[model samples]
Each structure stands twice: as C-alpha cells, then as structure tokens.
Target chain A: MSRVIQIAGLRYRYPDGTQALDGIDFHLNSGESVALFGANGSGKTTFVLHLNGLLRGEGSIEICGMRLADGTLEQIRSKVGVVFQDSDEQLFMPTVLEDVAFGPLNLGLSPDDALTRARTVLKRVGMAHAFERAPYHLSAGEKKRVAIAGVLAMDPEILVLDEPTTFLDPPTRRDLLSLLRSLPQAKVVVTHDANLARALTSRAVFFDQGRITGQGDVIEIIQRFHWEYS
Target chain B: MHHLVIDRWSRGSSSLHQRDPRAKLAALLVFLVVLSTTRPGAQWAFVAYAVLLILTANLARLPILGLASRAALVLPFSATFALLTWWSGDSLRALALAEKSFLSGTAALLLVGTTPLTGWTAALESWRVPRMLILVIQFVYRYLFVIAEQVQRMRWAALCRGPKQRGFRLAAGLVGVLFARSWQRADGIYHAMLARGFRGRFVPAPPAPFRSSDALFLSTCLAGCLAIRMLL
Candidate 1:
C-alpha cells in the first residue's frame, strides 16, 4: 500500500511557550485507519492539525507524495479532511446544505455542482431532510452526521476525526462507527473511546506529553496503555 | 432562542419572504430615510409609519406583537437620547426621537424577519459591502448561540456549587472564563475553516436572478415611503 501521510521530526510550540508536539514520526498507508490514543493534553490534536498544514510546526510533512509548502497548502488541505471535535465549530454555515457545500465551493466547484454534491453526500449520511434546517436546530447525532457530510462532500483521501463520538449516545455512537467503517479513506482518529478505536482502526498510536509512547496493533496498544476505564 | 424564532420566521412563505433580498433591502433604506427626515412635530407621520410597518407585518403573516416587542428592545438605548432632548425643553422632539427609533427598528426587523440571513447577506455582498464586515456579522450570528450555551452551562455549574454566589464578582469571573473559552473556540473555528481550504475570502454562492416582481416590489415601497413623507 502507498503511504498517504508521512511525518518526520515534527514539533510545535504554542505562542505561550508550551510544547504541544515534540519530535514525532508517523505514517499512514492508503486505506488504513489508525486511532490516536492519548490523554487530554497529549498532543494528539496538535499532531493531526499538522497533516493539513493548519498548524505550521517544524517538520517534514508530506501528504499523498506532495511535500508540505505554501503552494501545496491548498492541494494538501483538499486531500486531508479534518472533522473537528466540536460539531458547532465545524458547522458554521447558515444552513446544513450551505455548510456541506462550503468545502466544494472553496475547491472551485460551481455553485450548482457544489450544491448537488452536497445533497448527494447529505443523503449518503442520512441527513437529506435537514438541507434547509439551521445547524443550531439539529440534534447532537444529526449535527455529527452533517459535520461528517461536510467533510465527505470534499471527497478527501484521508479523514482526520477528533473525538467523533463526543456527545453521542450509545446507539448514535454505534451508527457513527458503522458509517465511518464503511468509508474508504485512510483515517487518523484522535479519540478517548477505546471501543471505537478497537472497532474502527487496525493500528493504534499512543502519545504522552507531546511524544509517541507506543504504536502497534489496535488491541495491543489498548491493552498496553490500560486505556479503558474499568 | 429568540434568534431561533427569527430564524424560523425568515423561512416563511409569505410574499414578503419570497421577494428578493435586494428589493426588501432597498425598501428598508427608503423607509429609514423618509422616517428619519420627517419633521419632529409631525406626530401623524410617525403614526403613519407605525401603521405602515404593522400593515407590512400583517402582509408578511408575522405576529405584529412579537415584532413590536422585540423591536422595543431598541427603546432603552434611544430613550437616553430622547431624555436629553426632553431635558433640553424639546418634548416634541424627544417623543419624535423615540418614535423614529422604534419605527426604524421595526422596519429593519421586518426585512430580516422576511429574508433569510443568507439571502440578506448575499444581497449585501452584491451591493459591494466589505467582505470582512460580512464575515464578522456571519460569524457573530453563527457562534452567538454557542457562546450563550456556554454561559448557561457555566452558570449552572456555579449554581450547583453555591446558590449564594450571585453578584458582580461571580458575573465578572464568568465573563473572564467565557472570553477565554470563546477565544479557544474561535481558534478552532479558524482551523476548521483552513482545513476545509478556506483562503482569505469566503467563496460566495451565486446570487439568484432578480425577477420583474422584485423590481415591482421595490417600486411599490419607494412610492409608499415617498407618498407618506410628502403627504402625511
């Protein structure tokens, strides 16, 4: 399998002088899914943000064979879709359809074509009935679904989801896991849910204080870290 | 929740709602200008303006009382200036000041009540309003609910700890924490935007075609405002 993401010697420090991501190396093969397991402040989110050039850290990062640079920023972003932890933050457009169309519109799709793509993806995610609805009006599950649809509309090669099941009930979480499992893109999921990691990912990486502490098969990583609450 | 109500109202199927946003915006401009220039002692003109707004609200199938009550939110701000005028021995001007402000608020609310945010903001974009200003407005409107919810949660947490913790100190602490949370949320939102390939400017959707009915609507509004100003 071809590598979709490759990172070497990656490090980031916040403006306030906090070391968020220490020197790290990681890679994801095409169609492979990896779960990032870490504590709240363990740099999981900071590391994933670098995949799409959202954060400018000191690193040699490549996406789908394209080196991270100013000119390749847009192309790289289009390749790596990041679904944020907070659905409210991600779904910023006035209506569900408009929000879903946002990425395509940015990627230079014509409004008509963009709206059509948005509709198809919304239907794919089973949110077809919420096209005209405001984002604030949606239930948590529906909002999560629409957020996923927004990213899917772009048709990225890699999906980076941070805590995708944050506010979901068990049934909603199960539905999301099934939907996520069906997607073909390579994924880097930053989550605390061991069950989700076990169910969706083949590999797992553990982070501690801005460094990778462990990496291996998903179940083994979970077992090694004592990740789940008893 | 109040904004949510306005949001739902904006999606109505009335003729006013169906009218092009540009047309309604033009009508709102005309009404504001005419009402602002009306003479202070012409109380009848103010009454006429109020009646005209009520009639438009009726035509739009909106609850007039709801519109009036929400519009009255502007009264306290205008009341201070109105009081100054009253203290300056121009009671007529003070009353007219309040009347003009109230009527203007109602008229503005009418346009937004009938036109969805995307519709009206798109109209503003077409009119060459600064893209940055529009972005700020859109962001503020979108995140207001999130911020409000945060405030409620924080307040609830505080109340859970101690019911007596209700005063300036608690309120001040809440504001400080809320500001920090909002800052973090803003950063997340900007990152989300960039991850979705947002460049410096937002990509606007293509504007809808303005039909002949839209032009007719603008003309009718212009004529009504002019007639009221000249005759009443």
Candidate 2:
C-alpha cells in the first residue's frame, strides 16, 4: 500500500519555551496499524494534534500525498478520522444522531445523506438505538462508541486515535480495541494499554522525549523494551 | 439529583413541535420584544398577548395550568421590583411589571414547548452558526443529564449511609466528588475527540429541505403577528 503520512524533521515548541516535539521523523503506510507508546507528557498527544493541524509544528508533514497547509487544514481534517480520548469533549451535541451527523454535514453533505451516513455508522458501532439519547445519559462505553461514529461519518482514510482506551471498563476497552482493529483506515494509536497495543497493532513506534526512539514490528519492539527493562 | 418524570408539555409533542426550530425561536423573540415594549398598563395589549399565548399553548398542546407555576418561577425575583412600584404608590407601574413578567414567561414556555432540544440545535447549525458555539450548546445539553445522573448517584450513596430520620442534607464532599467525576468524564470525551481528529469545530447540524407549507406558515404567522403589533 502507498504511504499515507510522511513526517520529516518535525519539531514543535509551545509558547512557554517548552519544546513538545524535538526533531522527529515517521511514516505510516495505508492500512497499517501502529501503536505510538510513551509516558505522560511524552508529546504523544501533541504529535496527534499535528496530524489534523489542531496544533502547528515546525518542519514537514504530509498526509495522503498532499502537503498539509494552514488553508487546507479543514480538508486534511476531513480526511483523517480522529477519535479523541475524551468522548465528552468530542460529542458536543444535544443528541446522538446530531453529534454523529456533524462531520458529514460540515463536509457539505445534504441533510438526508448526512443523517443516513450517521445512522449507518451508529449501527456499525452497535449504537443504532441511541439516535435521540443525550450523550450525558450514556455509559462510558456508549459515549466512546458514539464518538467513534461521529468520526466514522466522515469515513476518513486514516484514523488517528489519542489514547483510544482510557478509564473504560475492561469490556468496553476490549470492545473499543476490537472496533479500532476492524476499521479499514491506517491507524496511529497513542495508548498505554499494553494488551490493547499487542492485540490490535502490527507495528510499534516507541515515542520518548518528543521523538521516535524505536520503530519496528510490534513483537520485536515490545520484546526489546521488555528485555532491556527486565 | 434529577427526577425522570418531569412534566411532559415542557418536553412533548404538537404541531408547534413539528415547526422549524428557527421559526419558533424567531416568533418567541418577536413576541417577547413586542410585549416588553408596550406601556406598563397597556391593558388591551396585555390581554392580546395573553390571548395569543393561550392560542399557541393550545396549538402546542401545553397545559394552561402549568404555565402559572412556570410563570411563578420567574415572578418572585421580579416581584421585589414590582413591590417597589407598589410601595411608591405607582399602581400602574406595578401592573406593568406584572404584565411584562407574565408575558415573558408565557413567550418562553411557548417557545420551548414548540421546539424540542435537538431541533433547536439543528436550526442553529443550518444558520451557519460558529462550530465552537454550537458545540458548546450541544455539550451543555448532553451533559446536563450526565451531571444530573452523577448527582443522583451521589445522593443515593449518601442516603445509603445516612439514616432515614436524618432528612435530605447534602454532604459537603458530594459536590466535590460529583465535579471530579464529571471532570474525569469530560477528560475522556476530549481525548476521544482528539483521537478522531476533532479540531475544536463541531460537526454541523443537518438542515432539512424547506417545504412550501413551512414557508407559508412562517410568513403568515409572522406577518399577522407583526401587523397586530405595529399596525393594529
């Protein structure tokens, strides 16, 4: 498959003189699923923000053969389906159906088309009955599913997840991992769930001090890190 | 903690419920402005406003009785001001305050009764409302239930520990706990948005195709109301 993302010499600094990312390089191919592992404050979240240009970074990053630009951020956003870790912040709509339909409608789909797509994605996520339910009434698992549906309505080529599993009940976490594993888009999961990483990903990129310190097959990378520590 | 079985009309069905939310919003706003602009003792206008409110309530299938209780909720605060007018021997001013307060409540009740929460949001989206603003409203509406749920759970937990004879006294820690839990819940949602490539802008509300009937109804009602206020 063709390369879906290319990041070269990426460096990012916050306004407070804190460098969030330091000279990093990474690439992801279409259909690949990669785990981006790191400790807290390790720039994992910052790097994911750069994917959709929610946060600006220095140097070069290209998505789907198009060089990302300020003017084209919205277009790039539509193409990269991201499921934020916070389902509450992601689902900022009064009802489930409207929340899911948001992305497609923004992309200029007709109301009927957008609602149909929302229904399809919600059903796919096993949430067909929650069309009118408030996001607040939903359990954590349900909220996460609805958030995923919101992104799925966009049908992005690359789904970039920021800590896809967090604070979820074990069953919900497993279900979410399975759901992420099932999507066809290339994935970059920023997660601390070792089991989740092992079960869902084929490749691993060890992120440290704002850069990729190691990249290889999942087992090799996990084995290397485990052996070094043990 | 929130009760599940709140009054239905405050959250129910009628032809008013079926109308476009933007129309309902505009109608309510115009009606409120007209009612407020009237002289304090424009007795004729007050009767006209009350008549219009009742007619709309009938159309919206709302309970006329509950309108008073709902009106009462807004009355106490404004009553103090009305009391001042009464104390100053301005019975006319007092009457005006009373009329304005009741009419304002009537206008709001009609608006919310006619418009479901979701439809109001969809209307805002179709109007090219800023994504962030729409998202704020969406999040507030969705999580209002979540906050209610959290409070309910905490109250249940408190009751489990406290004796029945103790009465319904809220614990100091309960507020802190509820806020913390909701905060954490909010954190999870924010992270989910980031994962899915949410860049602060919310998904826009879908706009339904405008039917001729909708246009006709909106124009006639609005025009008639305007003529009554301005010309008559």
> Which prediction has the highest lDDT against the true structure?
1
Q: Show model 2 residue runs off by greater than 4 Å.
A: A56-62, A67-75, A93-95, A106-112, A132-137, A217-230, B1-11, B22-67, B90-96, B117-232
Candidate lDDT (C-alpha), each: 0.92, 0.77
User: TM-score of the candidate numbered 1?
Assistant: 0.90
lDDT of 2 by residue, A1-230 (tens): 79999999999999998899998899999999998887788889889888888788898989998888977777788878888776777887667887888778777678889899999999999999888776766888998899888988988998877777777988888787788778888988888766777888899988888988898998788877772333
> How many Å off is the CA of A42 in candidate 2?
1.5
Worst 10 residues of 1 chain A by lDDT: A45-54
Once model 1 is optimally superposed onto the true structure by TM-score, how far is the C-alpha of residue B179 displaced, in angstroms? 2.2
Q: Global lDDT for candidate 2? A: 0.77
Which candidate has the highest DockQ of all?
1
Docking class of 2: acceptable
Model 1 Cα shift for residue B19 (angstroms)? 0.8
lDDT of 1 by residue, A54-171 (tens): 8889989999999999999999999999999899999998899999999999999999999999999999999999998889899999999999999998899999999899879999
For model 1, state the Cα shift of residue B198 in Å.
Answer: 2.0
